[model samples]
Target chain A: MKRIDLDIRDGEFISLVGPSGCGKSTLLRIISGLEQQSGGSILLDGATVDRIRPRDRDLAMVFQSYALYPHLTVAENIAVPLVMRRLNTTERSLLGTLLPSAKAKRKEIAGEVGRVCDALSISMLKDRKPASLSGGQRQRVALARAMVRKPSAFLMDEPLSNLDAKMRVQARGEIAALHRQLGSTFIYVTHDQAEAMTMSDRIAVMMGGEILQVDTPDQIYQMPLDLRVAEFIGSPKINVLQAALTEGDVLSFTFADTANNRVQAAFRPEAARLAGIANAPLAGVIHHIENLGADLFVQVMTAGGNLVVVRCDPGGIRPAIGDKVGIVMDEARLHVFGTDNRRIEGSYRLEAPL
Target chain B: MTARSFVSSALRHTALLLIAAFALLPFAVMVSTSIKPADEIFSETLRWWPQKLAVIENYTEAFSAAPLMLYLMNGVVVTAAIFFLQVLVTLPAAYALAKLHFFGRRLAFGFVLFCLLIPYQAIAVPLFILLYYVGLLDSYSALVLPFTISVFGIFLMRQFFMGVPDDLVDAARMDGMSELSIVWRVMLPAAIPALTAFGVFSIVTHWNDYFWPLVAVSSDKYFTPPLGVMAFRNAEAGNDFGPLMAAATIIVAPLLCLFLLAQRRFIEGIAFTGIK
Candidate 1:
């Protein structure tokens, strides 16, 4: 009985991000009319698409596997959409027995193929079959195919998830550029936070078959609407330390019955600072350090049996393994989630990004 | 090569050759004995080669004994009818059985398998009586109707259709194609090998099927080639074995040619049909 209440304006580049099995893929399929949602209807540009066949829906989806028809060559695969679009029922009737339409459908298709291939920089791979193309090349062909249709919207589901890390980064920029170039509504789905962060103008973070938050990427990262969104939208997996918001707005944390546990202290690793204070605000043994030359993510196990990751500079000094490090995560950057697993009321007071 | 290895290789080849000769002996004897003059057949000694090739003479006489050209036309028409009819019916049924889900679907498919078990002979008399009542007896309808729905064709197509990725079909669906269009354009094109294999099977089965033609067709003009081949052994050729073997050779040659033409397709199709 759930509903997808989408009011995304045309030409918006929206990324649907979530963990696997969160139904982001199902949502994409339903929108494209490939599948039916048992209850609610899907509308395309103010028109109901519930009864429309997927081809007539004017929606093109680039599947996660690229779903390039393995039996078809690259040109033929890309040409499928155009063929379905232009060829009338008569012209396609059993070997074109019905008089062939003398229209310029072929010329139009050729022009479309040329334009899209150039945009995707894949003109050289026009006739090659999908098996001959590398992964990156296949991705571009998928993009070109989707773009060639000139559909009202493009539906892409985790298109970059199949590429290697470096290629994914390059492909990310290209997809974002393509979205802008077309100026069409793009509903994309991905499970990677980095992908969501780098490419999307706005992201709809879905979890457990529901959208937890839908907002611009900066708003999602800085002012998450849900506790799950806060944890899901960031890298180094945001640390969730159990604590309480006590009187006078002071947040304190502890782990035992004899100790007082209060407001939940959630913060990104880079927000925390390290100092040599004797009675440290937060202290732990330096357990695992991932040094990326510029910045280090030092994973530390606190005395309370909670793991707090702190990002520190590796400039001219390296903290020895197992050595105790005193750190204070900036209070202003901390986000608090309530017992209900919702963001604590009035906890996020940061400026909302435009 | 080592002595043992060489001996084993030779033994394997010798075994294969023997098996080949064993299988081919009747055919060789039939062709050889067919052209021996009527007087020399059943003589004290057997000859492996004909004194003269009398194939055209034998064929012309075989035609004269029966309207063989009419029978040949009938065989082509019936086999063609069966083959094309099978392709049409079984493809969509196979697509439905392999892909779609509806109420009582499993039961319906089980019934198709059950239909496979009901032998043609069990229903042939009943079918004839039905055809007689319906004014279809002695007509092509008798031969075509009862065999229109082929369980073997359906089974082969369904198995081959199973290996095609669900996503590919789903993609076609998403592309706005109806279920039937998907079957014709996507599924069938992808199943060319299977269709060819089943085409061969269907043609051979119907071509060699003399019993049904014998019962369904009382008209000599409607007799298929295999049924007409039966005319050679009438008492006129008693101990005149030459003509009978020539007819047998003709009967078997078409099957050999068909097998050679579709051998690779048959092997690959059957092997890959079970992929799903």
Candidate 2:
């Protein structure tokens, strides 16, 4: 990773969001001490933990595959960390069963396992092996295993990626609730922006091994510092148009194949409206209409041959395919980018048509 | 069942029965010859049923003529020792070859593959000389030590361990298990089926081994079952066919009983190893 620096606060839920191969999961692994970073050191609670082993790091990890031991029952799987931590070598042996202290320690361990299972609502599955559990159940078991220790923090690598769509939504809510109940630091990594947006206290947008921006989900969606961040954070991505800034602070954006005239501005689909051709700054033929029950998104093919999607209210006037219409940009909602792809600072009104 | 399926099943059963009979013909002849009296054996008119049964006498003579019990004990000791040592040596080696990354891992595995290509018998004379130099000949060490580091065992276990997911091992490490503990506690349990297959292969080969024991040990005390059988044939009653067959039966009985007891597991292990 190149010049990526992030600070996760105490009891905070932070998510690393990016496309695959963006080093999000790699950064998480480095934090967990599962993978070592070549150049940097990791500090946990003001102590350098980079050289520490994974077991000694006082951190728990939930893997994407939910790597539960298949031979162990759910309860035993959860008890593994406890057993390793609480018992000495001799106490973990078969002969240790005959020792009174060992028995007492085992009972105590069992009680903790029971409590974690009960908290996760998997108390009934304690006796079953991981192979027999469903994907969602296995995920809970993996969570229970990580939670049994009450570690300093939890590092999860795409923990919900394997679940079905419906299960993923429910699991997301459960994990958020779990974080609240545990009140522990969580560093979650995922390629899904929606997951990051909905669950994180703050989202760190990473790209090409660098963290582009770190802010609350609202701030990221509304005020992206870079163009790639703007495109990656939103669905039906923020529309980007090639444009030039002329004198009088005027911006002129032109579509392809139209060198004669330049239209001024770029805006998100929700920031544009269908208007009458005479007054609209840009004209296009409606290519497709998508009715999503509550809102409709209309795709327009402009005269300069660029496709622009406009989000319109379902109750309002809807245009059919092949209908010629003009697009009116919402002046206040328009986002202007300079040639360097940086957000332009000043705002100016459009010129009135003659 | 349908009429056509019934005919096919009948044909399959008939073919299976013929094959089974063909396989069992030798054993049946050995048992028949073992129980037959001297007069019935000499008057050989290909009669399977003996005119007079001499079960007790032939079996007792078979035991008494040679120290058969001692030889069986020796076979048990040597086979068990070899199997235990092989697993002790092979499991860790296989785990390392399958999982651990090091500078010379590929080269080490290449050497293991090269070792597999060389037949053990081809090296027996050199092995015997080595044992003699080490003063281990005519002892249990000579019988068991040469077979301890089994290349076949390592290869079989390496194949099985390769199928074990790396996630599980990493999980174990995260759970605070040392690498050695992971091999025994996690990998060993997971590789049980393959280990069982290798066990059968190892035990049967060592138990029935004749050429190695013949070359390695010269003393009667260290004689294995095959050598014991040889001693029985070299005795005065070597021409007595009934006791000879009885001795042969005794020598082969333990493995037969073992195979019968674990037939399902043995077959599953062998089949799993074959598919992989």
Candidate 3:
């Protein structure tokens, strides 16, 4: 968590995207005040809340485990935050109903719980416990509980990681819609890049303990500032080729220079295509082919012993195994990195065939 | 069912029935002796059914011989007070030992486990001396206060509370519950099975305790059921077998009824705590 400087805007959906153990969840916990950060201070709306307790911080969190009280029914679970806030100690006790004020407040809390349940379409599950509900239903109940509080911000840690694939997709849309309707600041933490890319206004790609880059999903995919960010964000990973900038300012894929002008050239599978072996800058042998009914991905072993995946059309001419083919990358889509792994912003053109 | 499984099942049932009857033989003898006339109890041949029934006389004589009802009431008061105070003390202590992170937490839990090793009788003399010095001897406080801090209850509850998830605690904290409220509102409800198990252990141990009562108090008015039975034997029902057996049966009847009512929860609690 060194030098973590993120300024999330109001009503913005920002995602902390990283692999496991990358300190994303830790950062979220620190923001929610569930955990303390030893070296940094957290400010909410220009006010420092480092010493504030989680209850007073006024931020709601949806844990990955759902964290619903098993003994409480769905409605009671949803009403917990409100009940704790609105009722005094005596009013929250067993004999609270005897007090006129408490009874009226309890009715108000019940109405809030009912409204939250209705908004989440979980009104029918109000009386049922979390144990009896399906994974998707319990997730909604957890959402309902967090939403019922109407906090200033929502901190969710992999909220949909427990659902089945189909439910995860459905829940993804529901959460996105919820963010739009509520228009509150949402800080989501997840390891799945697809979740971050699809749902977030700005995705913060994290690795090790630091945030590598923060940008919109489209910009993050097309123009990553860090080499690792580009490699981590896309499925069927981007390919990195060992290349050297020779004397004539030519990019040679097979030649490794003894001088310090060495660089790593990277490109996505869709940015490169197959060409005649004599005409392209790089050549490779087709290693394997994956046919997914609508798309074909061809894995090629380059002459420099690097495996690069190329996305090909299923209706195009399918290349056979062990055939040598030329690799022609979309020059504009190529991401060039310097020796220090920072993206080099320049136009790299192939002047002559390798 | 297959013949082999049937044979095996029959053999198992037969073995269980033998052990059950063996365990129940003393109780059956006590009940049979309580209902029989004195001369029939002394007969050479063992007979379950009494030739002359002395049920009414034995029961009336047992009730008249000593204040059995007062003894039962004393038993109820002492055991209930001890159990209630124990739960009041045990819940917070166990919650801290199981969940809270503090200085000397491990050391405190170690002390609890150490205390479980020392039986009550070993410390009974010091407890009696302490009660005497405090001028609480021969009173209900003497009976109840000595057994209030049950180390076994703490250990049992701590073990149960350890199984509860930390996420649930965090959730409660996020919901604005104070730590004490979380104990009663969340952990306590989830720990009912363990509480029931500890309750059975505490109540039965205290209700049937004889040595503690004998040493702690001297007044016949403060006598528990076990002490009352002893007093009844030496004072009024000397060598009166039928009345004595009747008194013994009456003293144990309440506990038996209670055990029957809580049998299911007791078993569930035992299994939940991983203690047979």
User: Distance from true position, residue B27, model 2, in Å?
Assistant: 3.9
**In every candidate, what fraction of the native interface contacts is reproduced?**
0.53, 0.55, 0.68
By lDDT, rank the candidates, best first.
Answer: 3, 2, 1
Best-matching candidate per TM-score: 3
Q: Model 3 in CAPRI terms: which quality?
A: medium
Lowest lDDT sum, 10 consecutive residues, model 1 chain A, at A345-354
lDDT of 3 by residue, B1-276 (tens): 999999999999999999999999999999999998888889999999998899999999999999999999999999999999999889889999998999999999999989989988999999989999999999999999988899998999999889888878888889898889989988898899899889989999999999999998899999999999989989845788899899999988998998888888888888887876
**Candidate 1 lDDT by residue in tens digits, A196-308:** 88888889988888888889888898777677898998878788887654453556653344544345567888888665646456677878888888888888888778888
Worst 10 residues of 2 chain B by lDDT: B267-276
DockQ of 3: 0.76
Give the per-residue lDDT digits (tens) of candidate 1, residues B1-276: 999999999999999999999998887878887777766666677777656666676666665655667767777888899888888899999999898877887888888888878989899999889988998878677777788899878888988888877777777776656788888878887888898888888888888998888889887667788877775465365545666666667777777898899999888887888733
Error of 1 at B87 (Å): 1.3
Clashing pairs in 1: A55-B175, A55-B176, A243-A262, A243-A263, A243-A264, A244-A262, A244-A263, A245-A263
Count clashing residue pairs in model 2: 0
Residue-level lDDT of model 3, residues A196-226, one tens digit each, is 9999999999999999999999999999999
How does model 3 fare in lDDT?
0.91
Cα deviation of A312 in candidate 1 (Å)?
2.5
Q: What is the interface RMSD of candidate 1, in Å?
A: 1.9
**DockQ, per-model, please?**
0.52, 0.65, 0.76
Residue A180 displacement in candidate 3 (angstroms): 0.3
